[model samples]
Each structure stands twice: as C-alpha cells, then as structure tokens.
Target: MAFDVDHVLAEATTEELAALVCGSGSWHTTGIPRLGVPPLRLADGPHGLRVTEQLLTQAVPATCFPTAAGLGSSWNPALLKRVGEALAHEAIALGVDVVLGPGLNIKRSPLCGRNFEYFSEDPLLSGTLSAALVYGLQSNGVGGCLKHFAVNNQETDRMRVDAVVAERTLREIYLAGFQRAVTAAAPWMVMCSYNRVNGTLASQNSWLLTDVLRGDWDYSGVVVSDWGAVYDRIAALIAGLDLEMPQAQGRAEAVAAAVEAGELSREVLEVAAERLLALTDKAASAVRPAGKIGHHDLARQAALESMVLLRNDGVLPLAPQAKVALIGAFAATPRYQGSGSSKVNPRELDRLLDTLSARCDVTYAPGFRLSGELDDDLIDEALLAAEDAEVIVACLGLPDAEEAEGFDRTHMRIPENQRALVASLSEAGKPVVVVLSNGAAVEVADWVEETSALLEAWLGGEAGALALAQVLTGEAEPSGRLTETLGLRLEDYPSALMFPGESGQVMYGEGVLVGYRGFDALEREVAFPFGFGLGYTTFRYDSLTLTDTGSVVTRDLRVAVSVTLTNTGERAGAEVVQVYVRNAPASVSRPVRELRGYTKVWLEPGETRTVIVGLGIDAFAFWSTPHERFVVESGVYAIEAGPHSRDLPLSGGLRLDVPRLPSALHDESTIAEWFADTEAMEALQARAVARTGERFALSEQMYTVVAGQPLRRFAMFPGGVLTAEDVDAVLAEYGRSV
Candidate 1:
C-alpha cells in the first residue's frame, strides 16, 4: 500500500507529531515509516553539493562551481541558472532532497568572512541572481533552500549577535534581497538565521517569520531553523518555524509538554505538522536518479565568465611563444574555494601551473606560503625564474585561514608574504600579471599600480585554474564585473566604525547607503568601483531614449529606456549595460543614484545592438517612514545609462506625478511640513506676521530653526506669536481642504 503523508499526519499522536517537526537523524528529518513519509535529506552549500551523513568528515565528491562571490560578478542570470541545474543533478547523485543554499545575504561588509557564499552588495542584484538559481534548481526536480534569512551578514558572533538595524534600513537594505527571492523564486524552504535580529532569535521572531514572510510576502513554504539555531522549540514553532534541523535533542518532548500544558495550542501544532507533511510530499516527488555527465566543463565556463579583469595594460593576451614565470604557491596548490560548511570536496582540482604548462613554456616557483614563515631561498628561486621569463604571472591571495566561516576578517590587506612576493616580482622589471584568488575584496592600492594587469578570480572552483589559463591566453574574454567596491582603505567604508559589533549588538549605522551607494553618497575614493570590469574589447553607449517621458501616476507605472551600444574595439567580447535612477529632491535623503536594472550583451567586433531596459515605480520609490511603506514622491527622475555606477555616458529624464494622500496635521508636525499645506499656511502666515511683525519673517536662517521645530513647540517659544488655538484653526482649515 502506498504511504499517504496526509493520512499519517492526521492520525499521528501528539508525541509523534512533535517528533516530525524536528530532525530524526543527522541532516535528515523524522518521517513516519508506517505512513510512508521518508526523511528529507539536506546537504551543504551554495556553490556545490557537499553531502555526507556525518557532519564533519568524509563529504561525497561533486562538481565545484565558482563561489557565490565569483558567480555574482558574472551578472549573468542565465549562467547562474545553468549552474543551478548542474547543482540539482549533483544533489540527486548524492541522494540529497534539499540543496541548502543560494545564500541570499547581502554583502554588507567586505570583511564578512562568508561573503564568498553571498551574491552582491546591492539587494536587487543579489535577489534577481539568487531567484534564477532557485528557479533552476527547483525546475530540475531538486528543492533549493534560500537561506540565512534576514540580516545574517557577518560571521562574527553569528549565533547570538543582535543585528540592531533601523526599520527603514532593515526593509530597504537588509531584508530586500530575501524579499525579492521569496516573491520571485518561491523556494521550497527558507532557513532562519542563527543570529538575533533586534534582540530576538530569528527562529522565534514571529514578526520576521510569520508577519513579514508569510503574511506580507505570501510565502507558503516551510520554515526550517539553521542547525542549532533553535533555542526554544515551542516558541520557534509558534513563530512560524515548521522544522528544526540536525535532529531533535529533547525539543520534541518540550513541544509535546507545551502543547499538553495548553501554553501552545493544538491548532498551531496541527498546522505545523500539515506544512511538514506537505514538504515531505514535495520532496518525495522531486527525487530523481543521478546522471552520468560531469560538470567540469561547465565549471570552467562559469569561472571564465566570473573573472573580473580589474586592470589591464597591454600585457595580457600574451604572445603564444612568450615564456612565462608563474609565481606563488596558489598557482601550484590553488585555494579554489572558501572554507567552512560550503567547502566542496571536488572530484578533481586543477592547478594554474599545470594548465599554463600545457599551453606554453612556463617556469614555476612557490614564491610565498599563504601563512607562517616565508622561505628566502624560494623567493630567490622565483626571482631567478622571473629574470629569464618574458612575462610574469603571480597568483596571490588571502589564505583559507585568513577569511572563513565562524569569524570576520580583521583587515582587508593581502597576506604580508604574498605582498612581498608581488613587490619583488614587480621590481624585477618584467611585466607582472597579478591574479587574486580570495573570496572577498582586498586592498590593492599598495601594489596594484606596479602590476601590468590584475585579475580578480574570487575563489573560483575546481576548474578555475583552467579558466584563468584561457583568459590569460585570450581563449576567453574577461566579462565579469566587481559586485562590491574595492575600497582604498578599510576606514573608507561607511560601516567601518561599527562593523562586527560588540556587546551582543551589531548596528547597521550606514542605513541604505551600502557598497557603491555609500561610497557615492560620501564621495569616497575607492580602488575599484562596483559593477566595474574591463573586457578584452571596448564598447560605446549612445542614442539614449525614454519611451515614456510623461508624468507617471500609478503604482504599476513603467518607463522603457533604450540605448544603442557598439563594440568599438577590435576584439569580440561581452559588456554589462547598467541602468541607474536618481530621484529629484524628495522628502527623504537618498543615494545620488541607485542601480535599477542591468543586462549583459555579447557582440562581435564592431557589432551594434539596441537594448531596452524597463523601469517600474519601485525603482523610483523610497521606504517612507511616514507612510510606513515604499512611496514615490512626485518629482523628476534622471535615468543614467552606463557601463558602471560611476561611468554614465548616456542620460534621460522622466517626470513622475504620483498621487500621495497627505497626512493629517498634528502638534508634532514641523512648521515646514505644515507650510506644505498651501491653504493652511496662507491662513496662518497672515495671522503670525500680524502678531510677531518682522520677527516671524521666513528668512533662510529663521526657516532653518523653525522649519524643523514642531508647531506645538514653536507656539510656546519666548517671543512666539502662534498659540494652540491658532495652530488648531490652521489644522482645521488644512483638514477641510483635504
């Protein structure tokens, strides 16, 4: 007889129902064998499948794709979708039901140890890319778990730190990506974060899990707690968490006790059990047999597209016969991916030296160890190799120990020994091509100018070395761009002062100004701007046009922007066209420009194509504290078309006249705010001038003081002429006008 999940859930005792809500065995959820419900097996990570019955040892071999940081730089949703499909195939091969990632956490800080597993600093970019990954995985009969929900950006004190963020910042910056992913992809599961959000554990936060996620976003999926994230199982369940991972350690008894004591209602338990049964049904149907094809070639292709060519000076695409000196241990023993739970045990790992040697005459030396003592003899050997070579390619990056899960990096500089190696190699008079292999941004200002070319290969996976070889030899074009800004110094970042907070609290003091948005807002200089990359060829953007230039009036308003782009250079390559929107002066302060939309296009030499990007009202709206929602203020919005945030060559404008219902006048309202009501101001101005004479004049300085002061407070000022009755009459008139 076929097992019926619903029938079992409906008849199961309270103890059995509680057990089903928690994990049964390691990495597997409890299932009723009599009812035919099988356990849902989850495995490690966003980049690849790292599955093992044991938590700490002996992971099964799988295809290792580029980390999220590297893939994020690609900005190609289609490529990410293909990677997701490949991951789904591997998950099935490993007998895993849910692939536990496509981690959608925002890259709030460059020093965030787990940034390698996240997408970008921008929420829209992170959400759109992650949604594509989620869609691809689910379409391939594998369930994708969108994870580390809400403000789980840093690894420091990750399990307990309270991320204290403002309401507007939380909505616009921190939670925006997860919101986008939930609404767009509809992943089967959402894993609650280990950290505390505003002093409440995410697992037990009803507002985050139930009100915002289920009620506001209409998410019908099961909510699973991050392993060990559940504190009070009953509280978590009540908060809309349907599952506890890594097995039940007395949590089932606790849930049963709570339900028996009448503290937790039986209805809630029944609902939770129903959701779990639904998830089990979904998982059972999604299971498929593994395929025979290996994704090594696809991994290489992904790596090739993910590499951001930070700087190039005619030394790249070397002559076929140019003898090369390959320095640094990373070239021989590559740190292809990040450490921690996301680490993949690849079927095979490639080395840069081996890949390069297969194509050209190459001399190799371990210029520096990633950690501890550096060998002077090895440095001398590397110098000797560089002395004889026509060009030098040095692979240098942060070691696995420098940045990884469970801790945040203290600084953003490259390891000292690697820095020394680069300095010596660059001083050797041979053109140096520096290849970086870290997961996050490192300061290159110290030695970047000396290098002839720079390639940011961020923890590329098993085939990263081969991809690097191809790009170095001009077999492929460097199409990836920087997803986060490469700052000149750590102090230049907006969150530098309060990052990785202390005393169990991390404050998001920077608000919505994160990454390039922060840098642009503060006008800080950075080593490389976000969305900046150099390809083998050049492209020119011209003939900018806005299809809808009239006033926008509705929430569903959209403006179509078209720009003609041409490959001006000789080489065939790809270019990412970025579109940004700047709202004319509004009630709230905003970034000078925010990225609204972007699309990547491939072109032959001298090819021209017109790309049309659509912009909706959300692109022009801000999270309004007064309105308690996203609102578009009636104003002119400037449309900027560019290769990156800082380099806009084409521009257009749109006038939007969104209708907004004015709030009722109150004592707490500012004088300027009251004056916004023209009829009310007209009635009060004449009465006030008559009482105070020249003292009540609206001069620039006088406006500065009184414009922000509350109307009630101004009425009580020493020389004030306005009274409570006077303000009430004006408000009454304002209310009448409405």
Candidate 2:
C-alpha cells in the first residue's frame, strides 16, 4: 500500500509513540513491501549512508567522498551527479534508505573548514549542483537528503554562532541554494542545521520551515534535525521541523502533552504527524518499485571522477604497474571526514595504501603527523622506501584538530613534521605525488612548486582510496574542478580582519563582495581564482552571441553564448564551461565578473563541438540602493566564457542599450528583499539582521507592503499579462479616470 502520512498519523496515538520512543517494538510497521528494498534498513548520512548496529562504524563499508570544500573546488557537476548515483547504489546494498548529503550551507567566511563539503562560493552553483546530486540519487530509488538547511556556513562556534545575513543577501546568497535544491530535487528529507537563522534557531524557524520550504517550494518530504540539534520539540514541531534524529529527547510525547495543555494546536500536531508519515510513505514507495545499479564499480568510478588534480608535472599515470612508495600515516589511517554531528561510524573504511597495494608494488612509511608535516627520521625512512620505487606518493594534510568544528584554525599551513617530510622527499629528484586529504583551502605553494604532482583526495569516503588508486594506475582520468580559490596567503581576502576577530559579532562590511567579488574588487590576484580547476584533457572555445536588448534596466536581457571544444587528448573526459560577466562600468565598485551560466560536456578523442549559454540582462546589474534601485547605467559588459574564472578562453563585449528601471520596480525589490530600503527602516533592519542577527528579523509587513508591486502585472499570465488593453479594463473596473 502507498504510504499515506495523513492516514498513518490519524491511526497514531500518544501511547503508540511512547511505546516506540522508549525503545519498544523498533517503530516497525506492516505495509506492502517495495520491490528493490532490503528486508531491513541500515542508513548512512549527514555524510553518507550507514549499515549494521554500531552507530559510528557499521557492517557495510561506504567509500567516503571528499569533503564539500574539496568537491566544491572540483566545480564538476557531472562528476557530482555520478558520485550521487554511486552513493545511492551503496545505500541500497547496505539496506540504507537515505544518504544525507550534499551539504548546502553558504561559505560565509573562509574560516569555515567544511566548505569542502559544499559547492561554489555562490548560491547558484551550490544549489544547482546539489539539485543534480539529489536527482541522480533518487534515480536509483534510494533518496538522498540535502542538508544543513539555512545559514550554517561557518564551523567554528558553529553550534552557537548565529549567521546574521541581511534578508536580501540571505535570500540571494545563503538560502537561495537550499531553496533551489528543494524546488528542483525534492529530496526525500531535509536536515536542518544546528545554528540559528535570522534570530530563531533553524529547528524552530516557522517562516523558514513552513512558509518557505513547504509553502513556496511545497516540499512534501520530512524535515530531520541535525543530530542533537533539537532544543524544544513542541516549538520545533509548531514551527514545522519534523522528526528529531538519533531519536528525540524527552519530548516524544510533547506534542500530545501540548495539545492537552492547549499550548500547541491540534492543527500543528496533525501537520507534523502528516509530514512524518509522508516521509515513511515515500520510503515505502521506493520499496515498491526498484531500479538497477552496480554498487562496487560505481563507487570506484565516482571517486575517480571526484578527485581533483591540483598540479601535476610529467609524472602522473605512474606506469600502470609501477612500484610506488606510499608515505604518510594517512596512507594507513585515513581521515575520511571531520568529526561532529555529521560524522558517521562507517561499516568499512578504505585506506589509501591498502587500496593502492592491490594494483601494484606499493610500499608505505608511517609519516603523517598531528599536523600535515614530517619528521627527519620518518622522512629518511620514506625517502629510503622510495629508493628503488618508480614513483613516490606521499599523503599529507590536516588532522581532526586543524579542520574540526569547535574552533577556527589559527593558521593555514602544513604542520612542521609533514612539511619537513614533503620538502625532504622533494629533494630526492624522484617523481613525488602529494595527495592532500583536507577539507578547506591550504597554502600548498611550497609543495606545489616542489612536487611532481598534487592530488586532492578530499575525505573521499569508502571509495576515496580506490579512486586515488585509479588516478595513479591510469585506469580513470582525473576530472574534478576547483570550487573555491586557493589564495597564496589568507590575508589576500578583504574579510581577513573580520575573520579572526569574532567576539559575538562579525561585520560584513564587504557587503555583496565575497569570493571572486573580493578578488575582482581590489584587482588582487589569487593563486587560483574562483570557478577554476584543471582537467587532464584539453578543450577549445569560440562563437559568442548576445541576443535581445532590454529597454528597462532591471528587465531581462537575453544573450546567447557558444564555445567550441575538442578532445585534445588520447582519452575522453568531461569539462565545465564557465560563463562569467564583467560589468563595463557600474555606479559602484563591482567584482571583475560574476558566474552567470555554466555547462558540462563530454568529448571523445579528437571530437569537437560548440556550446552556447544564455546570459540574463539582470546578470549585468547590481543593487545600487533600495530607493535608487538597480541601474544598468547604460554601459558595456564583458562576457568571458571558458574552463575557469582566470582561465577564460573567449571574451566579448556588449553595450547595455536599456533604460533605467522605473523607480518603483527597483525600490520594490530592494524593500522586499531587505527590510531597509528607506532610511526609516534601516535602523530596525540593522538590529534585526545584524545585532541579534539571526534572532531578530524584519516584520512581515516590512518585507511586503513597504512598496507595492511595480505595476501589478505580476498577477497577469499568458494573454492576461496586462497589455494597455488590460490596464484599460482595470481602470474601467475601478471607475477611475486615467
């Protein structure tokens, strides 16, 4: 039978819930079994799925993917999609229901260590890629959940610090990605973050959970709390966050008790129950109809696709059967993921040396440290191991403390011991492949300059080890791209000062300028710019077209873009063609260019094809003020489309031949976007969006009625989109003289 949440909840009682809550009958239910499902489920997530009884570690070994920051850097959506599919297959084999992943939090600051788990510094890429992952996972009939919903960008003080972004910026940058994922993928479940968004905690944000997720996006799935994230179950239920995970605290009967005390409404209770039952309904459905999947090979393939090659000299593809020196304790003891709520006790963990040894004569040296550096003795031993080896592969990077969630990292340097080991090994004049297993961006200048190759095997889970093995053995081509910039130094960013000095408040004086915006604003160069990553194969670019000029500045401007790509290698691979827009001249300082559109393509050896993407006119405009609105300023815009930001292959310019938006439209969006377009509401919004940041927020009235619709044509659709004739009809209805 199809699971009916409403019906299931109607049959549920406080007694039944209590019996299950205190560990009675496993909360088991009898329903028609789905086709593809296992008899019982063991789940994985926040990172990936899990199986067996042990909470952190389990029976089925899951190949862990790289952290969000590392995957984000790859900027390869196609690879992410493949990774998602592979995860789904693994989950099914493990009898897992959902793979809780593709963490979609914003990168509020660079101090965040888990940026590797997310994608893009911008919302568009993050949301777009997340949706792709969710879609691919569900393709296997195993649901994947989009996670850490709302402002959970930072890790240090993450559990307590409130992300107080302005309403407009919040909507455009932070929440936009989550909203997109919800609308596009409709993941089986959404896991709320542990932090507060706007003043109320995410677990209890009514507008966020109800008005936005369920109301706007109409998300029909269940909402799970980040482990230990639930504070008040009744309030969280009233606010519409359902299903506290790792099991609920003392509040399993809180809803019934609230109904008895008249503190919570029966309506709210039913709504929560329905949502919970709805989750079971979908899982039940997946059990009915199944899909075909190849779990083992998919795991290895995903890891291969997700691995990013930061730098490589002529020494890659280590001669198929080369005897290799795999140094570093990390080779044996891998840190697949950071510790905290998202951490899982995997059923199986694959170590790099273990996986690599199967393919060739791979010897190891215990050379990793509490830091990602080396000691003289360990280095000498590693160097000695490489004595007769054809290539030297050293696995070095951060440990749990360096990338943990409790505190911000004081420095972004490799540990002294690991540094000594790597630098010393580099002196041997042998091909040294340095594999970095970290989550955030690190200063690898020294290592890059000295090493023969660099591979970022970010906490690639169960499959991470074999993925690295394939890249070494030439079985698969490296296709991962970079998501964030790897600055030569941390201070290169404008948010540097505001970063380290966090005492209950951090000012976003940089405003809309973040990631590439900061780099473009000061004309400062980055070691690697945003939207950057190198592929083993090569591609070409040509053909740019800009179509449709708009009369109103804020109105849509359509521009078509095209590029020619050839498989400049013996092997076939994929590439992400990025389109960035440079504002010719603006009222205010703008970033060099913002990412507008991107497409991924695959090519066989010597094959060629052209790709064209459309650019919206609004992509050229930025917010000047709530009252002044967004003025195109009637200028030129430079369109650069290619593999990466700094690596633009084609460039062209187009004049804005448009008129400024009528003051009403700009003001309407500004006021509607932020509660502070006028000077009158500025102070109120500052306190709400900044002071208490997440706690205090703009009143709904301020978000809406401040400025009426531009011309009320919003209600119009198809032929009804108010032509002058429609306006005349409206005037007739009002009986007013026009």
Q: lDDT of all the models against the reference?
A: 0.87, 0.67
Task: Estimate the overall C-alpha local distance difference test score of candidate 2.
Answer: 0.67
Model 1, range 1-738, lDDT digits (tens) per residue? 235666886788898888889887778888877668777888887998888887898787888999999999999999999998898888877777788998989888999999999989999899989999999888877888998987998999999999998878988888888888899999989999999988899999998999999988999888999988998888998999999988856888988999899999988998888888887888786546565336999999999989999999999987886799999899988989999999998988899989999877899999987674667887889999998899999999988999998899999999888777887887899999999999999999989998999999999999999999999999899999999999999999989998999999999999999999999999999999999999999999999999864444545677888999999999999999999997689877888999899999999999999998888777887887666677778788899998998999999988777675555566678888777766666677777777766334567888987798887677776666677667777776654222
Error of 2 at 711 (Å): 26
How many collisions per candidate? 0, 51
Off by over 4 Å in 1: 1-6, 287-293, 549-552, 664-667, 677-702, 716-738
Of the candidates shown, which would achieve the greatest lDDT relative to the real structure? 1
Task: List TM-scores for all candidates, in order.
Answer: 0.95, 0.78
By summed lDDT, the worst window of 10 consecutive residues in model 2 runs over: 21-30
